[model samples]
Target: MDVLSDVMTVLRTGRPFAARFAKSGPWSDHRIGRPNGFGVQLMVRGTAVAVTEGGETYKLGPGDALLVPHGAAHLVADSPDTPPGPRCEPGHAFPGAVLRSDDPEATHVILCLAYELAPNRNHPLIATLPDFVHIPADPGERPGLAGAIAMLDGELASEQRGGDTLVPALLDAVLMYLLRALLGPRTVECRFAGWATALADKAVGPALEAIHAAPARQWTVASLGEVAGLSRSAFAKRFTELVGQPPLAYLTSWRLTMAARLLADTEAPLASIARQVGYGSEFAFAAAFKRDFGTPPGQFRKQAPACDPGAEPFRREAVAV
Candidate 1:
């Protein structure tokens, strides 16, 4: 029932991101211009009736979810009786979806947030989804989702102490639930591996896990192949097929990602940081880091990449030995 928790899980596993919820007014019918970012809409309290291109109209209710693609224009209204007005183009992706209100009296609450997907790692599962995705309340299949939506509605209405924080988190959780519903059952290509058709293979899972677990682990094609339970050639072939990159290349990029995280979070000695990430010395780590990041770690950190606490990079996930 915690929407933010659910959304964060998807974000942690697939992308790094943040989310915030806001209140919107009941309008007759208003055209929403182009969106600059991607997001989902969760109708917590009041109905959000709308019509999109091709004159398609949707009646969103509580517990329903809509996905706006990178940038799409649409209309939203308090009721179908309202007429849609003009539209504007923001020149950026502002795609979105709809959420319905449960009670006519409850204030219309909309949850919106953006995520940063991995580089060259567009989640195929997400792409299969339509620009606008709607998740209707299913009592039998997804009671938790429904319950979470209701809880968010109540908390937002109450506006008690900590409501702002609690409400946004709940809304995030709902988005994650929706993502799982869309991705968990699907298998898709692994851009980091070329030998496999899908990244969801049990074998591929371990290899990916190991790479994410220790980016600087002196990984060799043979070693990664061992983890994947494939011969070197087979692993190379399959991994290249699934992930679309040589295993070593992916490992290097991950290492740089890890370094970026350390630079932003800790003021640890450069040598210590290098050793921690598997380099024998600071010089070696610096060389590799620069090769990958186009700048030395110290300089990059000085420039100060954005540090979002919620989207910390390369934090190791515990792996079963």
Candidate 2:
């Protein structure tokens, strides 16, 4: 699997939630507090003003997107002076709530998304992201993000036959595009130096792919360096510089992350999971898991919520503004 896909597979928990809203006139501002997860706001039409927790304000126009990666409290309003109203409840649906204005031309449409990430297993890629990321709606600037927003807007606007199945997939695609837009070519030379840069490097990228592809392999610095077509010392230094950790350190973390997923999602035996994540024996794996997670694997499995096979893999709900 690709790096982003692999990271998301390990870090994402329950199904993501999303919604679209149609607002007209001068409405009371909405303050959203996501707590442990992240929230996304996209302006599909018209314009709005966004204020971060630190009082930073942004004017978001059509096609613009905002990501609250740290789950901070934020306000979205028709104008910067609009006072925030009551907190919106999760899963609340408002089809077409009338605001302060009845003018059809004053309507401001928005798409909102929420994601629940694994709190315990924070990946380097995610850790490297800032508290908030804003992507302006420039059609020719970042075509991927613009295209995703366009597709999502169309899908949400129309009542299609397979929309129930299609929208969730499209939301996931939009998320991928958003991340790509944030960590674009400009980030390679400055700012981001961890997983973002590592994934962009031709040499380090292949080595990371190899490790993620086969966590069970008995990998060494020399072996990984060979995969990157570099000498051991050079590869080690480069990997450390870009990935923000030694290769072995990252490998161990990845193995444990995979083990955590298997524990939560499957009934695989502890010994089996250990082997899958490259541990030689159950005892060793248990010790390592305890050290990393501060809980035994069995206990962790027992405490984790069971994955529902019959439920939708991705759930989305839209609220009217």
Candidate 3:
């Protein structure tokens, strides 16, 4: 699998939640906050404005999309001056709620999707992103994104058979498109060295895939350089420049991340977990784990909450329109 897909597999938890808002006339503002995850907003029609908690305002037009990666509390409104309505309780929505303006000419429609990530595990790629990633509407933009939005709109508008199974899958596709759009070559001028740059780099991308594909392998600078088709020194410099860390340092972080996942999700013994994460012995792995996580592996596991692998996906929730 590619680097983005692998990262999603490791970091994402539960299915995504989606809601649609259809309104005519002036609409009361809605505040959305996702403490445990992130929120994505798409303008399907008309116009709207999003005000971050920090007082930054972003105007969104039809076809525009925004990613609130930090889940900051924000206000969505038809205009900047619109007053916010009562706070919508979590997982509850008023039946037949629709916002109407005094003027008959105003109309707006929007779609919001929420994705839950592993709360305890903070992926480096996610950390590098800004508070928001905005993709403006463009007539010549990638058609796949528009098509996905259209399909999602259709699914929500009609009572089609198998929609329960299909909507979640479509939301997942929308997320992939959003990430791909954000990481596209056009955004290569990003200020910081992060996953977007690392994934796009010719040399670092392959090396990253290699490291992820074989976390248990006894890889060194030379081996990784061979994978990247670079000399050892060149590979180390480029990897560190684009990924914000030296190759070996990144490898250790990834290994420990995998070990933590195994500790939480599986019943494997500590020695096996150590071997799987490339440690030579239980003692060495425990030492590293303690240093990195500030807790021993056994205690970490004991304190971990029970994980329900078969938990239901995507509890539907909506905001008052």
Best prediction by TM-score: 2
Off by over 4 Å in 2: 89-106, 158-160, 185-191, 306-310, 313-321
Candidate 1 lDDT, tens digit per residue, 1-321?
122231233222222222223334545433353333345556655677656665777787766777664434567666666666444222122212112223334355544434433222233233434556666656578777777766765654333566435544665566566655544432552222232233356666578777766665888999999999999999988777666668887666556665666676678888888877778889999999988768898997786444343342222111111
Clash pairs, candidate 2, are: 19-318
| Model 3 regions lying over 4 Å from their true place | 30-36, 88-106, 158-161, 185-192, 302-310, 317-320
Clashes of each: 47, 1, 2
**TM match of model 3 to true structure:** 0.84
> How high is the CA lDDT of each candidate model?
0.55, 0.77, 0.75
Tens-digit per-residue lDDT, 1-321, candidate 3: 667777876666555556677777466556567665677888988998888878899999988998888676788888888887555322224211211112224387787776666677677788888888788876467788888888887676544577667777777788888787778753364444576788777788889989998988999999999999999999999998878889999999889887877887789999999999999999999999999889999998887543332345344333334
Which one is best on lDDT? 2
What is the Cα-based lDDT of residue 203 in candidate 3? 85
TM-score each candidate: 0.64, 0.88, 0.84
- Order the candidates by TM-score, highest first: 2, 3, 1
Predicted candidate 2 versus true structure: per-residue lDDT over 1-321, tens digit per residue: 777778875777666666666777576556566555667889977889888878998889998999887677778888887777667633333211111112246478777777667767788887887877887877787787788887877777655677666666777888888777777744454346688888878889889999999999999999999999999999999999999999999999999999998998899999999999999999999999999999999999987743332255333333444
Tell me each candidate's RMSD, in Å, in order: 9.2, 3.8, 4.4
Candidate 1 lands at a TM-score of: 0.64
Q: How does residue 109 of candidate 3 score in lDDT?
A: 75
Worst 10 residues of 3 by lDDT: 94-103
